[model samples]
Target: MIKLEQINKYYSLEEETLHVLKDVNFEIKEKEFVAVMGPSGSGKSTLINLIGFIDKKFEGKYLFEEKEITDFSDKELSAIRNKSVGFVFQNFSLIENNTVFENIELPLLYNGSAYTDTKARVQEVLTKVGLADKASKYPKQLSGGQQQRVAIARSIVNSPRFIIADEPTGALDSKTSEDIMQLFQDLNRQEGVTIILVTHNPEMVSYCDRLIRVKDGVIVEEELVK
Candidate 1:
């Protein structure tokens, strides 16, 4: 559902230009479970941000479902992102002071969804992530796994067609990380949510249907395990 061609991202310092991504190219199909693996400074996160529409200052063509979004304005990009994409960060970017329910409800609230509709949607996603019972709890009250579930619920509450997850299990222990990955697997299988995950863990690559390896901002190799 997403494609990038000849993508190049450069950052300008005071006297030097840093190239984060160089001629990157890839395509992710609908309902595909793809993993992006690489070492530090590999531009994996940079590519994620570009695809997620959070950063658009790169040179290249980006097409989502055949529509070129490279030159979309900020407002247009926001609308597209809100309607088409979801994000799960390693840090579980929850509002520390908000309850789980509140955190999940924030997106709908910002989108101006009706209160009744938002309530039902939030509850549904919370239950999907197995966090229904923890809805009233604050972020600090939940364990790492639970917090990540909340983050997942928040990400998927809008029923996004694609999800971009950056090191989704990075902060969790091994068991918890496995659980989280399983949750992602189930989401892909049951809901057909297209997932592009960035991870460094080789073991985690086994869970994905396809793997794309990046080095020095380019796709060096790819494997289809399933």
Candidate 2:
């Protein structure tokens, strides 16, 4: 459902043009669970940013489901992002002040759902993430795993075409990380949710269908998980 051709990205320092991604090319098919891994400063983040539609200043061709993303206006891109992509970061990125239901409802509201109409959809996702009873709680009141579950729920509440999970387990304990990974695996298997996971932990790749390794601004390896 996603394709990148000859992708190249750069950053400008005072006296140097730093190339971040070099001739990167890959395609993620529908319902595929893929993991992107690299050391620090390896450009995986930059690569995912472009894939997630957050960055347009690059030299490459990005086609989403056969449509050229580059052709979209900024406003159009934002709308596409709101509807097509779900993002889960290392930090939960939830509003500490809002109830879990409120946090998940934000996306629906942004998508034009009315306040009174958001409860059912929000409850549906909360139940899917195994947080059905915690919707009334606040982020600060939950464990790290619970908070991350809320974040994942919020991401999928919009029924995005794909989810970009950047270090979703980075902040959790090993057991909690395993639980989160299992949740992702279940979601992909049962719901056919396409996930592009960016993680530093090699162990995490065991749960993904494919592994993509990046190094020094290049995609160094692509292999099936087996």
Candidate 3:
């Protein structure tokens, strides 16, 4: 469903140029759970940003389901991003003041859903993430795992083509992390949600179908996980 060809990205820092992604090439098929592993300076994050339509200034071709992403206008790209990608982060990124239902409803509202009509969809995703009862609670009132579950609910409430999860379990305890990972696995295996995970935790890799390891702005390994 996604393809990158001869992708290269660079940054201009003062007087010197730094390469961020070097001739990266890969494709992620539909419903696949892929993990990207790399050190701090590696270009995994940059690679995902490009895939998720957040970065457009790169030397390469990106094709999503055979359509060229570079062909879209900024507004069109934003629309495509809103409709085609969901993002999860290490820090959850929920609104502190919004109720769980409110947080999950934001994307639908951005897509022009009426505020009055968002409850059913919000409740559906909340149930999918196992937080149906917590819909009226604020982020501060939830445990870390529940908070992250809310974040996951928010991401999938829009039903994007794929999810980009970057260090999703970083803040939780190990047991909580396992629970979150299991939830992710269930999402992938049962619901067929395509997921691209960027994590430093090797234990997390075990849950994925494939692994791609990056180093110094290059992909050094790509293989199916056993």
Lowest lDDT 10-residue stretch of candidate 3:
39-48
* Candidate-wise lDDT, in order: 0.92, 0.96, 0.94
List residue ranges in candidate 3 displaced over 4 A: none
The 10 consecutive residues of candidate 2 with the worst lDDT sum are 118-127
Cα misplacement distance, residue 125 of candidate 1 (Å): 0.8
Q: How many collisions per candidate?
A: 0, 0, 0
Distance from true position, residue 29, model 1, in Å?
0.4
Which model scores highest in lDDT? 2
TM-score of each: 0.97, 0.99, 0.99
lDDT of 1 by residue, 165-184 (tens): 89999999999999999999
- Candidate 1, position 218, lDDT: 87
lDDT of 3: 0.94
What ranking emerges by TM-score with the best candidate at the front?
A: 2, 3, 1
What residue runs in model 1 are displaced by over 4 Å at the alpha carbon? none
Instruction: Return the clash pairs for model 2, or none.
Output: none
User: Looking at model 1, which ten-residue stretch has the lowest summed lDDT?
Assistant: 110-119
Tens digits of lDDT, candidate 2, 1-226 = 9999999999999999999999999999999999999999999999999999999999989999999999999999999999999999899999989999999999999999999999999999999999999988999999999999999999999999999999999999999999999999999999999999999899999999999999999999999997
Clash count, predicted structure 2: 0
